[model samples]
Target: SQKIEQNSEALNIQEGKTATLTCNYTNYSPAYLQWYRQDPGRGPVFLLLIRENEKEKRKERLKVTFDTTLKQSLFHITASQPADSATYLCAFNDYKLSFGAGTTVTVRA
Candidate 1:
């Protein structure tokens, strides 16, 4: 079966700095990649999506990069603030969206 993995550990960072997250995949080549932010109890809210051929995509302070050659993706949040803290998920399009475990981020004032 295919698998997508993100660091389960919570990341802590100071305010005004960038927060980076990583997603690794195996056993499949997806058509596109999507990112979302989830609160502790709520469902994930879509952020950005990048195609297999797209090297990078951005929206405001959020940036996403996909590398089919490396079978990995990188997600970045610039000038992070306390409000930016949340669990970030990486999903792939394979007739449907398959999600990773999600990585939590925390920003301190």
Candidate 2:
């Protein structure tokens, strides 16, 4: 069986700082990992995706790193703002899409 886990507690960070979130998985080797942001009552917005062979990927102020050796992924938001505050989710696909519980980020201005 495969399992994914994210930070169980909400993350609180000051505006203009970077926020980092972690996703860990067990018993699965996914081809790629994806990150998404979900605002209250809205569907998740795609952020970044990193492949198993890739070490790192970036898009605008977002960055993602994939480490198949550790079966973990890291999601980063640089110079985060209040608008960036949302529940971030990490998902991966082996045969099917699997998702973490998601970590809520609150960027205080």
TM-score per prediction, in order, is 0.97, 0.96
lDDT of 1 at 32: 91
The TM-score that candidate 1 achieves is 0.97
Residues 85-107 of candidate 2 have per-residue lDDT tens digits of 99999998666668899999999
Clashes of each: 0, 0
lDDT score, candidate 1, position 27: 95
In model 1, pairs of residues that clash are none
lDDT scores in order: 0.94, 0.93
Which runs in model 2 stand beyond 4 Å of their true positions? none
Candidate 2 has which clashing residue pairs, if any?
Answer: none
Error of 2 at 38 (Å): 0.7
lDDT of 2 at 61: 93
Q: Could you tell me the lDDT of residue 68 within candidate 1?
A: 98
Best by TM-score: 1
